[model samples]
Target: MSDATTSDPGTRARPVDVSERVALLDVLRGFALWGVFVSNSFAWFSGYVLLPRAQAQALSAPGLEAVVSGLYHFFVNQKFITLFSFLFGLGFSIQLARAEARKSSIVPLYSRRLGVLLAIGLVHLVAVWAGDILSTYAVLGFMLLLFRQRSDRTVLTWAGGLLVAVPLLAPFVQHYGPILLHGAQAAAQAAKASNEIDLRAKEQLLAGLSSDSFWTAQAANARFLTHMVPQSKRLLWMASILGRFLLGLLAGRYLLLQEVERRRSWHHRLLFWGLVLGVLGNGAGVVMQRLRLAGLVDPARDPWMLAMSAVMEVGFLGLAAAYVAAFALLFQRERWRRVMQVLAPVGRMALTNYLLQSVVSLCLYDGWGLGLIGKLPPSRCVALTLIIFALQVPFSHAWLSRFRFGPAEWLWRSLTYGRRQPMRLAPGDAPASMTG
Candidate 1:
């Protein structure tokens, strides 16, 4: 018998299993992570600041553009990142559950993991691109740890408040903040744009690709790091990225404590409402953008425009939750379960795939490689995502067949344990049975 103390004085302690892991959740995470690439592929490939506007303008006609915008408005951007954030929260809760079961301290273990992640993210940011989110997530994860032992209600209350407060105040800050701040931001953006334009021009004029392109790219990137990243960080904080992280952590706790999918009828209802709200909120954004384009209104400076974006963000959160619920419920079926099981390996090795994305993007976009950035249309980008994902599916399965863990996962585990972890799937090794 265990001797752990419960929140209630009369309750007996239960034994904890620290190694307990959720395969299905990991599979769902893999799906959500991949969705990010799907949603961001067009923007990543095209270097477009506003993807919806680019899609709208690049399509065959105004009517077609509206259709494309309407489709993407309801489906992309807002949802994928929310899904990833929610999964992060879910992962944190899972870690907590295992720690509690084993009567182990979660802080040390999780802190080490986050520290490694931050280091990895920093390297990735400077060496690859500054748009990396992992470092931001690592920073937010540290903050989230402070709330680990708090009651779900407390966490939810605080998270809800932050989520609402941040967006509500964003417009006020953007509008009322010092004129100097705005001027500085504009100057920073102009300088960065000018540098980028110069690089692009050089690439166009140069007859053949050479080692010089790499040096030039690095030089341009250094300027962006110096002049733009700090300002961008300020804007990102003001835009409530931290608030979203809190919301995600709250949602994760809810999923763990409530066993959200076990309640089938409620899950279905949530899914239905998610779809309905997502369509309505995203539609509003589309309409506003269209009107702004037509000169009927100026949404860029409007508070209501910020509100619309918030609504869309909420729609995304709701839909992502619905997806989790639906997937959990559907996973009871054998065929569906097997499909997800295949995905579990990829999720387990997400760090590898995430970095793989950077490598692939660099090859496709950089002057030293294919150099397709700012050239592909939305449709072709979508096609590229499909092809890449297809390749990943089989590659993941094949790699997992011969190994106990993904290469990156093995390395992380080895570092965490301060010892070499086994990498091969032994002859007698067997896959765990699926469970809800």
Candidate 2:
């Protein structure tokens, strides 16, 4: 009910030119990456990998860890991921425009791009980490192609329909949750009944991701992914991501970003209402989860969980929109603009950073690297996240100052276009697509 958008005539001239981008989008994306890094850090460093996969979220916490988890649940959980999905959708719109502008084929190019993304994500999931979303994004991206030529209302309707359907249909879906949960629980119990393993040692090695031998952690990861990846590919996950993509499409289709000044009034309204609705919505979801955790609500009660989750889902959508609007509005000012521009490079090289973040975090936390998984409390994880991203800020700038694309991004673009792209920044260098 709180959604609002405005299109301005003055800003409707040309589509988003990649060489000359709306710096605001880059800045927003860069900022969102940080949020994502922090959110994932909470999981990795705060004991996500330590527990049995099903029971990770079920672990109890006290004091600062609880506070941190609660805050992340309300303010972060879907907010940043929503932003990521939205940007993906927006990038698609831009890609479509660019191809059309150049009289090029859209499907073949886009398909190749998504294919490469899926490949990279698969490797990342199997070898480095199991929390990869790229493969799923690649899969859902194909679905987006079906809606591309549709009218704005059609796109919105499909997106909204999916969003609303997730919570409503979840009651039906949870018929599987209990059965699956039970099976997984039994399997876990059976696995734990091992003769050749030490419980404490196994838990420590797996939890800390520490490795006394090569491929040991990786073997554990493979086992985890066998269970985990399928769980992530569930309908709710895809629907939520797809819904945000549709919203991003709407923003891109209207070119609403082109006229930030003209749209200030709407941006202000979105900011005010977005925060109000977003907080309450996400908060309801968090409370619902907490209740379920505390045994106040039955885990098998799909209807109640679905209903509350719907509220939470809607709230996340609203809040994500509000963030975009808030950032868009701020881009028109100077007080925070200069500072925020620092992330522009990071966003510009988002792909490289995304993969870099996973590799770096795994090396720092996983048993394979520093093995400091359970050791880092929320407070220290928070600090570590800041340190990681702080280093990335300057690193991104320095890299972009000379190169046209980040290493991964460059490879992706080259494969996407079926040609070598100019990696070095030159006077005539002008990007034709959103490389990331």
Candidate 3:
């Protein structure tokens, strides 16, 4: 992350107390954020809609299929979000600690932070991609404050129950609940997916041959936009994402109260168990998929498939948590620390970088921009993600070196407080004294 140096003449001589220890967590956040981008890049550049059997199935190859399924089983919606959520929870605790040290009110200060996050998320959703998590996290954070003073055991018990209950209950409710509840919505979604796939396929076929096909191009663009808006909204209901979020909250509460990462042997034990469970869960998922493909089982009608998916998700999250704690405990040296420090800046400015990803990707892949969607392969997508992240790291470091906060973060703080916040940083820059 960027070093804190005051640049504003008015604040040049003030003391700054940004926690340097959190750099480790920031590095983990960077890793999680990048993993999400890797997965998103596939959809952003590949013109591969993840729904409607035809387009999704078309992308499947014997070799790639296993890779994709394995990834989906282990990483896709599980690990990355889990990491992000845990960071959020950890951040909450960090904020509280800072507030307490200053004898400030935690609620007002945190509420302001969440408000800023919500606004940033809204911009990300409507103006950019709709699969934004900031708004959701911000909303949930407010609810979490109620338990801020609760014992760690209470937080863990409630969080664990919610984590398990949401997924297992959601599917059954959707399946058996009144049709007026979610059935019509589900049916509409399926129909929309079918139509979108057909439209995209036609567009791809035509665009492959000529650039002068204006009508087809226009139709394709319209269909793509129409499909994406609702699709992003639908994500709120996805059991996987919500479950990860809850798990992250649980971890956050633990870290805030327990300092779980401080225990070396416990961290190792978690790592070992996480690895074992992850292997079993992912292995079971692979077996189920293979069986379904081989006609030995039918996942569409079988409850076992869903059960397996749940297990895999839990395992993946567990593994991710363990990995994060292990890294915190083990990689505290200079070389690794420097790498993490670089990542910390970007992670600290996650909102800025996330929106930046949308902007940059849109320019490179969207028809309205560079129009490279559906043209790149998985390897190229990964390459681009690396390139973009590399540029962002230095940029973030430079920006933070001279400023009190990221540009977006500054704006968020300003709006939340109803006043202009100091932005530039020089030696001894200090944040404003405020109640939590």
Candidate 4:
């Protein structure tokens, strides 16, 4: 497929054709989905996050689960999500470029697109799972429009500032905000009261999720979404996500992935530095986590907390960047490229597959289904994740062969354009031939 930009100023803005996609981006998206699935399954879907701290720790298997847990913290946790966010930003940049090439206004079409995405995200969040990132992404996506006309340097600066400031500022805010609002004595009392309430809420959530009725589970999910999760924390987290998006935008503006060979040396540099920083940052994070778990360190304390904050803030970016660089370099080779391209189909239908993962896992773990919540150990969760993803690989291939878009993608497009999209591939279209 040619890497040519699709332009249709004479017509309404529609989805890009299969042939116009950059295959590597699709491949990367597919790859990221696996890690995202693994992370979500192990952390959220398994009901591990809702368990009491002691009970959760007790469920960890000694030998292999320890290793699996370590590997997940070091490599899997936030890294793929970071990559996914970058891809979203990169995709936006591509769309903006397409609009410019076509000499058309991007506002109307792009706004509709984001609006549709936001609607989908809200539905997914309320009905499906509380761990949904789509709603957050859809909301933050609107902010991307503000930077569309900004200079590259300005974009880079804001991205860097937000990325750095969020971590540094979060610690200070969490530690001091209550004290500033109330007195120190009152703040301590509030903290104690808040912790107690949170515990009770989580226990209730656990009960709701473990109940046999779907309505019960849904009510619990709704309560958690609306009241349990703190808004201030969510906003801080959004800043980091926006930072990553800006970074992706910068990359897209330069068409870095589009001309990988020409920027080979730059990729090499990114690979080297990214690996160095990823190891240092994520490695420190692993150690800090272990110490906290061991009760040797308190993340609520001063310098240790600061260090931990910094690591948590920027650690994922280094590794995610390394993955992108490494993937690009390997994709330059025929042999490696062939193997990685297997993920392209999955990536092409990423939205469908992502939502599918939530649905499938809820059935396997939630009360209304198999009710395996809090039962599976970390090792088994990892195993289940792999098994499910293994099935999805072929399923994506089969589905994409006969269809123009995944079901979710088709719906999104149809809604955005106010018309039903062509689902079945045209007579002459290749079964497996399409771009993201």
lDDT of each: 0.61, 0.72, 0.60, 0.85
Clashing pairs in 2: 209-367, 210-367
Ranking of all candidate structures by their TM-score, best first = 4, 2, 1, 3
Candidate 1, superposed: residue stretches over 4 Å from native: 1-20, 50-56, 59-69, 179-212, 232-261, 300-303, 431-436
Tens digit of per-residue lDDT, candidate 4, span 264-285: 9989998998888889888998
Q: Which segments of candidate 2 are over 4 A away from where they belong? A: 1-19, 49-60, 176-208, 301-303, 427-436
> Quick one: how many clashes does candidate 2 have?
2
Q: What are the TM-scores, per candidate, against the unseen true structure?
A: 0.81, 0.83, 0.76, 0.96
Model 4, residue 280: distance off in Å is 1.0
To one decimal, what is the Cα RMSD in angstroms of model 3 from the true structure? Answer: 6.5
For 72-107, candidate 2 gives per-residue lDDT tens digits of 788887789888888888877766766666655568
The candidate, 2 or 4, that scores higher on TM-score is 4
Worst 10 residues of 4 by lDDT: 1-10
